[model samples]
Target: MRISTFEYFTSGVSTMNNQQASLSNLYAEISSGKSLQTAADNPLGAAQAVALTAQAANLAQYSTNQSSALTSLQQEDSTLTSVTNVMQSIQSLVVNAGNGTLNDTDRSALATQLQGYRSTLMTLANTTDANGNYIFAGFQGGSKPFNDNASGVGATYAGGPGQRQVQISDTRTINVADPGSAIFQSVSSNESSPVSSGSAANTGSGTIGPVSVTNSNDPANSSTYTITFGTTTTGTPPTTSTVSSYSVTALDPATGTTTTVTPPTPYTAGDNITLGSQTVAISGTPASGDTFTVAPANTGNVSDTDIFTTLDSLVNALKQPADSTSSLATLQNALTTAGTKISNTYNNVLTTQTAVGGREQEVTATQTAMQTTSTQTASNLSDLVSVNLPAAISQYEMTQTSLQAAQQAFAQIQKMSLFNYLSS
Candidate 1:
């Protein structure tokens, strides 16, 4: 097979060019430290790397979110701790007030201290985060959580229901706050006082008649007492009777004389009575209910009142000497009730703290799983498209040597002449 000189020269040039191109590619790989500089170099690997890089970026964002969520949760936890302390203070104050030895002056002084504590508690309930958002205000972050008249009327919560949450991971969210209102205002079954009303009368003495009271005055006080009668009703009307100051006398219908009767304690909706010679016992003080009515007798009535307000009234009542023993006892009951409320509130705070801890654990676990997955994905991507420096450098050197040899052979061939052929 005879080959033309031009064809031979062209084939030698092509071979040298191919070797140079291979060396250039190897050098580029070594210098750039990437096996695939462009999509064309390793299409599949390049595509995989792009996807992995995007995933890594997303993971980084999730990590940032997790960090922010953790900070917020920690802040919330701190605020709750402060609130718990304030509640404890209030509980202690309630306990101090419950002691009977504490005179009106002592109680009034305690109430002053209690009011200060209440103010502090209000401030805690209205606490804000670093972002200046109220922590206990639910979505209404700009609003205050607690409102008060500041005059012993007690505090009221103005914020919405608890609904704060934190995004701890890409797919998981957790509650970061519980509302102050729910924690402070939850009513317990034991705390509620049932409704009662009635009228009572003294039959044996002078001016004995049915005494009507209102719901506000029902169970007028906590002290238990009894109504005593001196006589029985022989007949009706215009009865004149003599009775001991302690005895409650009723008017006789026929004899127009006084009859003694006994009163019952904790008088229910339908209680009837007749005067007797002996005294009748009642468990609780007489007070009117919402529907209480008397045919003809005393006309004073009471209204429905809660423990907090009752204690407050008692504190002020102690300031006055005319305040009845019944009112004092009512105040005592209110103090007891307030104590229970304080205890329940503290328990609720504990419940919320427990929930927060569980959520924190969940966030930690999610973060760990995401970090591990992201790291493995990044490593796999590096293996697919990243270059091995030592191997690339060796390959580049071999290609360069091949190219030099091709160039020398081509030069020797080109130097061939007719004179050289004749001498040989």
Candidate 2:
């Protein structure tokens, strides 16, 4: 092979340039501590690294979401516990109020204590989260759930239905808050009694507080019975009643409207008033225009009520006077009905507690899974992009040697080149 001067010089310069470029790339790798700086370096590895990196980012975000969900649920759980305790205290007050041995002075004191519990329960129902959202307000987190009733009787539910859930994991969502209506207001009464009493507005001096179910087969009996004070008028055919009988108006508790119900037969003083499953005797010469209500204690409307309204009603029933009728037996029935309502309320709170626990378990599991996935993804990413320090150093040294040799050979060849000879 005959090599011309021009060809030899050109080839030597090309060799030196390529060696320098290799050295520069090695330096870049060392500085960055990355095996490959761009996708061009290793297309398959780069693609894999990209997938792993994205997976890691998603896992980290899921972990964060799980943490937030757990925190909110825990806060809600603590709030519910406080509410249960408050209800329990209220229950104790109700049980104590039933003691017939306690007089007006003692019963009044118990009622005052019940009022305090109602205040505490309202505070709990209005619980808030770290972000200032009301926990029991469902989707209306920014709004308060319970407020004083317009009638000034008890706290009313102002929030939406149940809570809205957040995604704790890719597969599952969990409830973070339970509203007050489901937790407190769902309690219903077991039987019927007087919810309202006749005032002087009704001409009848006769009074009735609450009625009792003395017979069987009337568990679901919700018939409404009323007593009109005026005596029955006698006609040629004795249309209304031969005796001075009080008129009875029957109502349905489910409808909350007036309907025909069987009035206690005879309707005389101290007579056992029987209407469906309900029975109560009324006495005390009732004047014209007086009326009394006989219905169930649980009106099934807790959305606007605190469970303790029945307790307050019981207290009021106890204080009512005994005017030869509607005092002793009526008061006893009220106490029993109030106790039933409180019991139902307590059961609902317990059910809510169970639901909270279930949510906690779900969130905790999701957190663990996300954390594990993040850790594994991070390891894979490290392998794909991170440089092996010792291997890089060895390769860098070899590249440096190659570059130095190229420079030395090029320098020697320059003296013999046609360009140098031509210049000389």
The per-model lDDT (C-alpha) reads: 0.57, 0.70
lDDT of 1 by residue, 1-424 (tens): 9777788799899999999888888888888777887899878878888998888888888887777767767776777788678777777777777676777678778767766666666677788888888888876788887676478555566777867776656677777766766555542332322222122221111111222222324322222223332223333567654322223334443344644343322232223422221121233333322111111111111112222333344345334332445545445444543454455456666677666677777777878998898889888878887789888888888888888899999999887767788988
**In model 1, what is the error at residue 373, expressed in angstroms?**
1.7
Top candidate, metric TM-score: 2
TM value for model 2: 0.72
Q: Tell me the deviation in Å of residue 228 in model 1.
A: 20
Worst window of 10 by summed lDDT in candidate 1: 294-303
| Candidate 1 clash figure, as a count | 41
